[model samples]
Target: MPLTFHWFLPTNGDSRDVVGGGHGSPATVSGRDRPPTVAYLSQIARAAEDLGFVGALTPTGAWCEDAWLTTAMVSQNTQRLKFLVAFRPGFVSPTLAAQMASTFQRQSGGRLLLNVVTGGESQEQRAYGDFLDKDDRYRRTGEFLQVVRGLWEGQTVDLVGEHLQIEGAKLARVPDPVPEVYFGGSSPIAGKIAARHADVYLTWGEPPAAVAEKIARIRGLAEKDGRSVRFGIRLHVITRDTSEQAWAEARRLLDGFDPETVRAVQAGLARSESEGQRRMLALHGGGSDALEIHPNLWAGIGLVRGGAGTALVGSHEEVAERIADYHRLGIDEFVLSGYPHLEEAYWFGEGVLPRLRTQGLWQHPFDTRTPPSAQVPFAGAATAR
Candidate 1:
């Protein structure tokens, strides 16, 4: 399959500096210059669409705008971009969630993709009135997907599970081209749930060997159950015209991280119940040193970030090479973001995507027309009046 790339909508806010806060950490609102208004988010959405991204992911959390509502509004601004809306399963009933997805698909012209988040933090989950422990939440997620899938298939689902109960549940009108479910977790239970239920198993950016291990494990489990799953990775990026410039840009973001904020965020994230978060913490060990965990792979972003803490930092060719490396390891999709999403979208879209196209690893998800001729050299062109 041709590689699919997706951009992020920074629903909490956008900033030049690293916007810390995800999972269990506090959302950094201080340096956020661009509030996540419909206009601003629509700008990013349109850019991603025009740049040939297949979709844009909108995150869900107490710190961020509601993913469903935000994406529903942003979807109207783009004709071709799908919205990978993230939502916690424990927060909403499966039947209602299915119905909402059905409506979103119809309204958005079948541009809906679901990212199922099984709540990982106890305190955050309780704040929303969910008391299930980490393991139970994964169990509940399994039941939730079962019910949701059945309804989307136009079946009368009746399942009496430990976590969820559904009786005679059916959608009035099934979603035409049912939305794909994207799920991720690092625990054993998470792998099991994903193998049995997920269409694409997502992972925070890890080294190629680690990612390959995950893919193998999930494939084994899925094969046992007569199923197969695609793979995706989430990461921040810093691609530039030259290697020196990209590394310098990465250094700038690293330099912006306040020592105290990193300490505090690390302390808060230390108490997280997520296995994935644990692995991310181990990658840097709460220190700023040796952030280049792998070739062109930087862990500096994970210093204050809770979830995806790594990034691919290098020139367009190097970044494209790193993506190709992961692709060889079985990653069919990439969910990527940067400090300031708008300009970064253009950087990666124009720079790296073209290289990938030349390598025959990617093609525009929506457009196939030959690109327009290169703009005439500014120095040679007549000045506009």
Candidate 2:
């Protein structure tokens, strides 16, 4: 299948300088400037749409602006782009969640895609007065999805699971096209939940080998359930006109990181019980050195970002090569973002995507009318004898 690409909205604020605070971290002052205004986020969304991205992921957490609201407002600005709204299942009742999704789908013309984030950090959950531990939270997510799925299917749900008790929960109007559930977790329980529930299983930007291993693990569990699920990988991307320009940009982003801030953030991330967060910390060891863990794959983002700490950094061709490598390993969807979201969208959209199209690996999801070869520069090259 042709690959699908998605961009990210830095609703947490963005700048040329590194913007900190993600996952468990409190919104830290980078001492840099940039506010996450709706206008700015809409700009990024519009750019992604123009660039042929299928969707834009609005992250959910205490560190960023609310994903639901941000995406809802931003959706009004773009015509063909979907919003992969990241939201925790535990924070809201399943029935209401279904209603919100239905309403969003109607309002946005089926442009809503949900990313189910089972809260990973206890401290952050507690801040919201949710005291469930990691395992219990996963249980809640399972129950939550059960009820929400039933409601979305136009059934009156009366589910009495261990973590949820919904009596007669139903949506008066079912969503015409039920939103696809995008989920990620590294724990054993997480794998089980994903196999049982997810339409698309998501993972952070791990190396190709690691991603393949994870895919195998998920496949094993999914086979037991007799169901198949697609896979997606999320990462930051830094593409430029040339490989040298890309690496220089990567180095500049690394240069701005304060060692003390790295230590402080790593310490906080280290306390996280999330296996995914732990894996991210191990990638770069919270250091500024040796960030190129693999060719065109930089671990520098791990120095401060909690989730998806690595990035695909290189020229458009190199970035396309790495993406194809992942695609070969069974990644059909990519959720990519970069520092200063708007500009990076242009870089990746104009740069790597054309190359992927030339290789016959990708086609725009929203532009079914436009023939692929017509839109892609190297399409004729691909067909040449």
Candidate 3:
């Protein structure tokens, strides 16, 4: 399969500095210069569409805008960009979720992708009235997908699973093309669920060896079930004309991290029930030193951010090489973002993507028109200030 790329919509907000929040940490509010209004988000959406991104991911959380509602509104502003809406299965009924996806698929011209996030923090889940323990949440997620998938297949589902019980669940009109399911988790249960249902299994930015191990494990499990699952990795990015410039940008973001905020966010994440969060913490160990855990891969982002902590930081060619390294290990998709999403999208879209294109590793999914040349100058000098 051809490689695919997607960008993130910082629905909580955007900033030149890193905007902290995810996994269970509170969003840092001091530097959020751009609020997530429809107008601003639509600007990012339209930019991602024109730059050749297949989709944009809107995150789901109490800290961020509601993914379904926000994407539904933002979808109206862009013609071809699919919204990879992140949603928790436990917050809503499976039947209603299925119906809403069917509606979104029809209304958005078949531009919908689902990122199934099994809520990982107990305190946050309790706030939303979901009381299941960590492992049981994964179980509930499996059951939820079962019903949702059956309904999307135009079947009237009747299942009495351990966590969810549904009867006669069917969509009035099934989605013309069923939305692809994107899922991620680091635990054994998560692997099983991905094997059974996920069209694409996602992992956070780990080193090449770690990611390869995960791909092998998931492939083994999926093969046992007579299935195959594609792979994707999520990460922040800082690509520039030279390695030194990229590292300088990384240092700038790191310098902006308030020590107190890092301590508080790290403390909150320490209590998280997510195995994935555990691995991320191990990469930097809640300290700021030795953050370049791998060549051109920086862990400084994890100091304050709660999830997807590591970043690919290098010149455009080096970043493109890192992406190819992952692709050789079975990752077909990359979900990427940078500190200030709008400007960074242009950085990677114009800088790194064309490099990948020339290497025959990627092609635009929407049209035959070529993307802007890698040499095209970006006008967002304000981001540097």
- Candidate that scores best on lDDT: 1
Q: How close to the true structure is residue 60 of candidate 1, measured as C-alpha lDDT? A: 78
Candidate 3 Cα misplacement greater than 4 A, ranges:
369-385
Report the C-alpha lDDT of model 1 over 1-385, residue by residue, as the tens digit: 7899999999989998888777777644446888989999999998888888899888877888999999999888677889999999999899999999999999999999999999789998888999989999999999999999999999999999998888999899999879999999999999999999999999999999999999999999999989999999999999999999999999998899999988989999999999999999999999989989999999999887789999999999999999999999999999999979999999999999999999999998766653312224475368722
Q: State the C-alpha lDDT per candidate.
A: 0.91, 0.88, 0.90
Model 2: pairs clashing at backbone N, Cα or C within 3 Å: none
lDDT of 2 by residue, 274-382 (tens): 9998888888887777878888889888787777788999999999999989989989999999988888899999988989999999877666565332345466568
Model 3 agreement with the true structure over 93-167: per-residue lDDT tens digits: 999999999999999999999999998888889989999998899999999998999999899999999988888
Q: Which of candidates 2 and 3 reaches a greater lDDT? A: 3
Mark the regions of model 2 whose C-alpha exceeds 4 Å error after superposition: 29-32, 368-385
Score candidate 2 by TM-score against the native: 0.94
Clashing pairs in 1: none
- Arrange candidates by TM-score, highest first: which order? 1, 3, 2
RMSD in Å for all candidates: 5.1, 6.1, 5.2
TM-scores vs. true structure, each candidate:
0.95, 0.94, 0.95
Output the TM-score of candidate 1: 0.95
Q: Which ranking of candidates, highest lDDT first?
A: 1, 3, 2
